[model samples]
Target: MDFWQWYVRRGRIDRRTWWLQYALPIGVLSVLALMADVALGNSSLESIATGETGYGPIVTLVGLLALPASVSSGATRLHDRGMSAWWLLIGLVPLFGQITLLVLTGFLRGDGGPNRYGPPPSAAPTAGPYLQPEPAPEPDRPPYWG
Candidate 1:
């Protein structure tokens, strides 16, 4: 599916998609925004990175701009894990909320086949992020009754 179509948040996505397509872009953009914030004298990178101060305007704006994509993409990952999008709310909790959601949506494996959420996402990047996973070929073996 196209990035615009995936942005609607209606399907499942595997870890690779969640990482490469969603998380990676968001992270890279956020870093660029942080550099802009520093250049604008809004906040120092060391201070923000050390948690002495929160991110400044540019970073915040970039994060806000990316919020919908983040939420929807995260939901798709949750769907791939065979859970509903509501699970994204876990990020609302203090401290552990975001951490738990990160692990659940980013680290764990998704359902191995077609699930309630939909078929598994494509393993190949060129085929697009959302496609049926290729079926595994059977292994060579002796006959059961031989």
Candidate 2:
């Protein structure tokens, strides 16, 4: 899938691509945030490593900017699972809700075929013409000499 479709577009996304789309940006931003904290020299590596407030507003701004893409991609992933995108709002329920959403998107598989969202992300090729089974050979005579 294209870059835009993977992150911004409102379409179906299989579970595998969902993790990639979700983790890649978050991981990059986290690394950049840590680097920024080190560059400022206002905190220790331990603080940055633990995600403490060290880099100031840069990390916050980047996180805010990345939010829409994350939410949109997550919504599309929910669609692939034959669920409403609004289900993502369940994450608002605190720790349990977050874990629930994680399991739904990460562990569960999407619908096997086209759904209300669209065709499956990894659709199998259409079946070819059916081949008839070969006829079984006749049993050999038990005793031709008889």
- Candidate that would win on lDDT: 1
Off by over 4 Å in 1: 1-3, 46-54, 123-146
- The clash count for each model shown is 0, 0
Alpha carbon lDDT of residue 128, candidate 2? 52
* Candidate 2 lDDT over residue span 17-93, tens digit each: 77776757677986797578567775567775688755556666777777877888778889999999899999999
lDDT (C-alpha, whole model) for all candidates: 0.85, 0.77
For model 1, the local distance difference test gives 0.85
Q: Write the per-residue lDDT of candidate 1 for residues 8-81, one digit (tens) a residue.
A: 77768889878998899899999899889999999997997689999898888998989999999998899888
**What's the residue-level lDDT of 76 in candidate 2?**
83
Which parts of model 2 are misplaced by more than 4 Å? 1-3, 41-55, 124-146
RMSD of each: 8.8, 9.0
